[model samples]
Target chain A: MNKFREGGWHILLLLICLVLLLPVVFMISNSFKTLQDSYHSMLQIIPLHPTFSNYTTLGRQIDLLRLIWNTFFMAAIVTLGKLITGLFAAYAFKYFSFKGKKWIYLIFVSTIFVPFTVIMIPNYLVISKINLLNTAPGVALPQMCDATGIMLFLKAMDKIPKSLIESLKIDGISSHMILKDIIIPILRPSIISIGAIFFINSWNEYVWPTLILKDKSSFTLPLALQNYISSEGGTNFPLAMALSTIMIIVPLFIYLIFQRYILNSISNSGLK
Target chain B: MNSSGSKNKFLTIAYLSPTAVILLVFMVIPILYTLYLSFFDWNLISPTKNFVGLENYTSIFTDSVNRKVLLNTIVYILLLLILNFIIPYFISLIVKFFINKMKNSYKIIFFIPSLFSLVVGAMLFSWIMNPISGPVAFLMRHFGVALPNWTNSSAMAIVMLCLITNWKVFGYNFVLLLTGLGSIPQNIIDATKIDSIPRWKMVRDIVLPLNKSIAFYVLILTIVQGLQYVFTPISVITQGGPYYGSSNIFYHTYLNAFVLYKTGNASALAVITFLVFLILLYLEMKFVEGRMGNCE
Candidate 1:
């Protein structure tokens, strides 16, 4: 009886996994199909008449390469900014005994609870006032101060032995030198893990970029894809799928490469 | 010694300034500004602003459609809390039980959906759930069953929105719960085994208690992040359509601000939403604090 139950359990698990993966499979398979093939043969997992027309058309219609570059550039800058600022703040909180340190930490962490919707309109106003709208830096700057990243770095920094820092200080090492030589090496994995998260998140960001970026040439892949979808209005299914495929490829690649680090960081930190 | 102490303080300020400044300028000030903007009637482009004292708030309460939007927002959040956090939680346990050897592979596979941009996921699902020529319709035809236009029908739109959002988010929560499960000390598991405690009882008595903190964290995240999660699907797929059927307060606010350019109304909605979530956050923190104190 136990054996039978175990067998049933395995089958159920497999079925669940399949259900989770089916949409992804559907997406990739259909991206290669012709427009008629996609519409007419919706149930087919593998395209009967596969073609590259969807992709070629996508490239011609929109600046696919530029969209890709814009996304990569924005994500990189945001990740870099978050890492630097997060490290500095985490270092201060972890290493120093300053007045109002606890209060400052609380304030920073509380920003996590403030949903972006609350600040959306005002932030837009600020951006537009400064004339940073439609620019890459504008899209990246507001989101760079990541509370979760600071908290993650702070936790990681807390684990570093205080004695080691003291010894480095005795050697007349500056705090910056100590951080460069000691703490960073120890926290490299966590940093990379957190960086992957920052990259993926900023790359996948839609609403903020949509709000900030007005020019078509400046549009990130997500906003561009959303625009294409709304503009096309389901008239061209295959091309939309193709564009969706292109938009996801880089992030999917990043995720696959850093899957271990990403999972490790998420498990270690309490971040979702 | 005093000089070194002052220098240390200077360094601390220098190191902390970037984060502090950004938070103050972008986060803190914006929230304050949003509150201030809630009372005004402004189109965001016009040079003139009119003060409409308490009118936006009054309409939010009195306007029937706005009331329904609020109700829909609450319903969406409740559905997400149950489907996104609660269900995946139990599923995570079962998955943990089954996938002992291939855990990493299974995790990656499940998380694939989450890796896709929400816009991309929304677009992809818009096709899959397309009523006329999409796979869902085709499959329904094959099975001799009718699959309603998932995104268009008022009745099914919100439920379908919930399901799609759950699809994108379930793996992340599952992994989180799995981490919670993994933290269950082996010694306790061994003790439970030696006692021959029934499996379900072991889970209840030993596992559930220890996992309470992480579970609470997930629950809180679900509630706090619920609006952002539903925004994508509502925008890309449903457009909160079939006569505002699937529109939550967040999307409603977005439409008011960006699409309709009613900046004042949108800001008012945002302020109200913030207050509501603030209360939710307080309750969650209080609950978790009490539970954690007991656990320790």
Candidate 2:
């Protein structure tokens, strides 16, 4: 029974994996084909005659470096900001018990339920009123304060043994010292996981940027790619395919960099 | 000592300040403004704000086109919820089997789509579904099958949208369930096997029950994500069209605010959606927190 089960499961897993991979495989294959070939053989898994013309045409069409830099910079800033803000808040809640801590945390967590749409008009108003619209900071600012990050960090911090805190206290360590020395080090994995999640969230964010940003020069990769497709540029299939391939590639690269942290957070959040 | 206590209080307040202020300024204030705007008959460009009480909400119900939009949203949500569960469960089951043999390297590979921005996902898919050169079309051609313009047909568009969303998100679920499965003890499986439980029964009776906590989270996440999906592809690829066939309340609400500048009506729609999500989230919390085992 065990041998049979193992064989059946492996076969099933491999088959599903293939189904999962086919679209991506097709994307890469078509990227190497001429526009005419790509369209005519749209479903082809193997390109009849591969070419790099798409990549060259794509390079001529958009400022690829600026788009990549803008996206990476925005994601990095948001990830860093969220980590600092969320960590400080979590640490304060965990180490220093104060009145209304529970209610305060509750209020923070409640914000998670509020769809970002509810605040769209107001946030836009604020941005425009401050004259920060179309700026990178405007795009990145809203992501800095995250209730989910705070809550996740708090949950992780709560799991730290009280013995560690007591031992540090006996040695005359201050709460700040404990936070810096003990808590931060212990929470490294959580930080990596949380930061990766934030980076992914910020990198792929679309609507807010679409609503707030106007200038084509400042458009992130996703927005730029969107413009490319909505225009459809019927004869520019190779350029479009090239841009599409690049857009997917950036995030895919990031995922490769942080897959373990992402997978960990994915499962842990599932448990919570 | 007094200073220290006061300082701690100050630090706590400081810690809470960023999230509180941002939520107030961005979320709470926007909602209030949306509420205020919804009460007024003002185009976003107009300097004048004329208050009209409940007219927008009333109009939404009375207008037949708007009614269709509401129905379309419901259909999209239902379809998305179904795809969300089935696709992720099957993917996670596959991942679960492979975990024993390979590292979750394969799981990570599969989950790569989740990391992509919706703009990227929609565009990539648009390219893939491009009738001329898209992968889906290519595959159909290989099978000697004629491919309908999947992304252009309103009904097919929504289903395709659901498929794209599921592809990106199921990996997130797969990873989560895999983690949940990983935490389950080998001894428990041994016990189940010794009890002569068939593999399917073992999964149903033991694994499913044990993993209900994570399952609950998956449901809540899918529901919320499904509801909000309007903005991603809608804003980027479809603009909720080939007509109004693909638009949901979320996108409709966005169009009201961003395009039509009907802040008042958009606010009303957002509030309505908010209430729906709240009710669904509450139901989920109750399901997870009530009589649920071990993950507690």
Error of 2 at A23 (Å): 2.2
Q: Ten residues in a row with the worst lDDT in model 1 chain A?
A: A227-236
Model 1, B1-296: lDDT tens digits are: 88888989999999999998999888989989988888999898999989999888898889887888888888888899998998888877766653445666767777777777887777766777777666777888888987776656666888878877788888888888888888778898889779988777887887889788788888877877766888988888778887788899999998888888888888999998889878876776675664221100
> For each candidate, what TM-score against the reference?
0.95, 0.91
Give the distance in Å from residue B7's predicted Cα in candidate 1 to where it truly belongs: 0.7
Docking class of 2: medium
Top lDDT model: 1
Q: For residues A42-61, write the lDDT of model 2, one tens digit per residue.
A: 66668888889888777787
Angstrom error at residue A115, model 1? 1.3
Best-fitting candidate, scored by DockQ: 1
For candidate 1, the per-residue lDDT at B225 reads 74
Error of 2 at A260 (Å): 2.0
Candidate 1 lDDT: 0.81
Fnat across every predicted model, in order = 0.64, 0.58
* lDDT of each candidate versus the true structure: 0.81, 0.73
RMSD of each: 2.5, 3.1
